[model samples]
Target: MAGNAGVSKPRTAAPAASWFGALEPDHAGDSGDDGGNDAAHSRYDRGEWRASDVADSRFLSRQARRIAESGQSGLYRLYRAFVAARAALGITLLATEIAFAWLITSHPQHGAALVLCAVYALATLALWLLPNLLGPSRPTVAARLRRRQWAATIGVDLLAFGGLQLLGGLLNYTALLVLPALMAGVLTPRLQALGVAAASTLIVLLATQWNAGVAGATPLLLAQAGLAGAGLFVITLLAGELSGRLAREERTARGSLAMARRQAQLNRLVLEELQEGVLVVDRRGRVRAANPAARGLIGEPQDSSGESFALAGVAAWEPLARAVDRAFAEGGWPEEGRDVLLPRDQGPRQLRVRVRFTQRREARVAEDYCVLFVEDVRTVQARVRQEKLAAMGRVSAGIAHEIRNPLAAIMQANALMAEDASSAEQQQLTRMVGENAERLKRIVDDMMEVAPGLVPTPAPLDATAQVAAVCSEWARTVQLPPGAASPLTVELPAQAVGVLFDGEHLRRVLVNLLDNALRHGSRSAGAVRVWLGVADDLHARLGVASDGPPIAPEVERYLFEPFFSTRSRGTGLGLYICRELCERYGASIEYGSRGVPERHRNEFSVAMRRALLPDSESRPHLGP
Candidate 1:
């Protein structure tokens, strides 16, 4: 044990660290005169140093304490109910005493009987009210103390009844004696219950003899009293034993319930964090629970009212609903998932829906349910594609390293052949050979671009300004006539939109998009528009849209594929290169034929990662 600052290390061995130990400081300490300067300095020098002291008891979190208190609250509620029941029994006793006293008022000891009854009634009322009136708002009284209080109260009432019988010259109050004794047996310890039984029997025996007007005790009367005491004791002991067993059972049930609740919460947390969507549905096809991923896959909000919607209700989910019906028809889970198409603004998305049925047994009945695991096909395909591309890139890079030397020699030989040709036809053949070699070289360059490990170094830049600049530079470099360039329009947001992008990579993506748009665009003003804007608040949008004729669905599908070109002269690697560069910077390039309103234009949009702007700047106005 050592002292540093005001912290004192415990003399005992440090306790084992638990999962939650990180919440507390390692060292035990009191606040010091250094005003935390020493602690701060120590923390600075030894960054992981814990400067404050914590005891083993501090391991329990606030949530754990709350859960513990909740379990105890249930026990407390049961105890209160028992107390109330006892109070109610006391009230019943008071009523019986009043009626008995009225019925026997003409007796010689009427005055004493009436007084005793009055005392008993008042005592019962107090027993009923005291528990409610006493102690703090949320009292934590011990179980032993509460039981003792009840026993003492009930004992006094029993003695009062005994005295009334003795004074009134009536027979033993055997029926009245049982009430307090039974309650004592149920609520108090075995010894206390036995004591109550013995005391009650003695009171009744004395009262019976006094009522008999006997000078001396008879042997028959003594035997009768002994028999009565034995019966009372047996009742008390058996009743108390039963009550103890019932209490133990109740505690066990409560513990099981608490454990169930904790497990359910943990299961829900795990479900919510899963990448696949999980939907719990009843046999009727109503969604019982849809996790966040499921909601996202279904194009619904996390807090959506999808649970209320039948599986067949939403038009977008019709395909999935049909798939579910087929699975349910088989009366079990399908071995393989069914693929379904969903509509999105970007394009049609593919999803795989899987079903699993669960039967829950409750008492004599069984309830059946099913869980649907919905996974996006795009995500799965993307992961598979990325793996394949990585493998291909490694092999291609090795192959390209070997092929370049021979390719270089071939091009040199073609050039030499062209120089030595004597006739125009010979020169033409050599020229064609040289041209094909150059095309092969270009294809190799494009393949190199597609190879993996091209990491983009992103920097915060104004997307609107960068895009406008790129478009202007493109038009100037193309050297188009003023009339031809007039068709190219730059539509920038009123304010600058911040985005994270590599300047060179973004320039390349924009150049390729603009080049394609200009070639196929309508020969009219504002026919080709480059829009820089924001999308979903999390991404900056840079779209190259053209008022060009709609492309065929089949053509649009492979537009971004490398070496897939429509024109004879087109290389077809332009869009593919653009996609590779955009992906390197964590951006996406998507093609659309009918996305923009009032203009059925072909668009290639690049969604760049949005950057947080400083407080000094305000967000740009999103145009209507």
Candidate 2:
């Protein structure tokens, strides 16, 4: 409701032509269907077909139902007011008859008139005191009974006034009939109101003729009674029209209120879920509303206890308070947003603050409030850095494509030269050329894999065999002896473990991890360990651990980030490429310490989903 002050009023209905536009039939479809078109036109002329009878019947019915439902409260209040008015009128009528009976002793039916007046007063009082007595307990039944109750009330008023007028001679009781006529017009339909007016007019004429025949009155008295009846008809018509207009306005106001509430709820939901901070602050630095992100940015607790706080209350928020004050002082927001630094015990937090004012027409300066949009500078910088890295990767991928052909030619030439070399020095030179060319080729392949379209097709592979073969080859190449005395230790489960991964991609990942371990390990027995086992029924785990110093916290943060490494000679793409390949196969790789407390070692581990076996095999079998 607070934010809904600016909601516009509901629109009024369109002109008559526009309202009935949908009732027109399609001429295109009617060209070959003259008989049906004529029947439809006849129905329309006879007033049997309306806009509601057209294709929008459901829409009209729903709108009518909503209007009836929304009007129930106002209807109940009006009914109560009418009941109270009837009771007062009944009391007044009874008092007037009592006074007349006391003053007129020759009147024969004065006593009977007093008795009728007393009974009518009691009946109206009972209905006023217990309005629900006329209706049943169920809502639908009560609604139907309540409608009839209005007619019954009007009828009783007419009968009581008519009886009193006939019994009392020359008392002029016709004025009381106006009350019933007005009540019928306001509470009942137009046809019902007109019927009540006609019935009242008939009763007046009958009473006047009876009195004239009994007392020999003049014809001029009959003319006065007719004029009185005409006045009642005019009053009923005017009251009915005003009441109908009032009901329409009430329904429109209710619909506007409901729409405003829904819009406010939607705005609150959007603000709560927004990533950027939003705060509404007044001129005195009081925070009217603060979203979750804003509380987090300002280091305020997120629990909403409904207690109010000011920005000036927090020492670190002084800069923000000053910005709000400046916006209010200048009577406008800054063209460029300013940055504010909050000094915390941990470090200074940089925030970009943009302000906008909520101003009303002819509003005082104190009534205006400012909305602040806050964002973290570090997050903005990180997003920009990621975009730059993405552009650099695209350029590097193109360069890798260009180097691929020449690098392959160089490797082929070096192999041919090695075969022709007779001298040891010449052979050594050719071997170096071949090794360097192969290294360059591996770099190019890794770069090319960074392209977005590359998708690896994974297949079921024996984890135990892959780890065993990779570890054996690596140990042999490093010239480490195979036994308990070897620096490299390889462990595998007795049962084969299967995983979903591309064979060559898995081989490349394992080779990279082993190379890093060997380069960093102390080269002692059991210094480098490789193990393959089942993590769970759904996954297989592979880990490589080495006796190396714990990586620094800052370096560990960027362990898998591209182009980041502590070693000056390191390309930094090795670990990055390994992570990319693992993720492609729905696997994850992470670095942590995994050994025992006495001999803690830095470890890199991979978790890959266990491969699904065929129906014939109950479990994974070793692959050939």
What TM-scores do the predictions have?
A: 0.54, 0.75
lDDT score of residue 142 within candidate 1: 19
Candidate 1 residue 73 C-alpha distance from true site, Å = 6.6
TM-score of 1: 0.54
lDDT of 1 by residue, 320-409 (tens): 777777766766555677788987778888998888767532342333567899988888888887688668667876786677789999
Q: Write the per-residue lDDT of candidate 2 for residues 1-624, one digit (tens) a residue.
A: 100001111122222100001112222221231221111111011111222222222223455545434323333455557678879988997898778777887778777888988988987888777645644221210111122364447777888988977775647889889988887676555666777899888878888887777676567978988998999899989977776666556545445444444566677789999988999887799888888898888887334676357888678888888888887887776556788998878899999888887774256645567889998998777888989989988998899999999999999989889999999999999989988898888889889876677587788887777777777777777788667778787778877677999877888899889888878888878888888888889999999888877777888889888888778867789899999889999999999975446343799999999986443233332211
Clashes of 2: 0
Top candidate by lDDT: 2
Per candidate, the number of residue pairs that clash is 3, 0
Q: How much does each candidate deviate from the true structure in C-alpha RMSD? A: 13.6, 10.4
Clash pairs, model 2 backbone: none
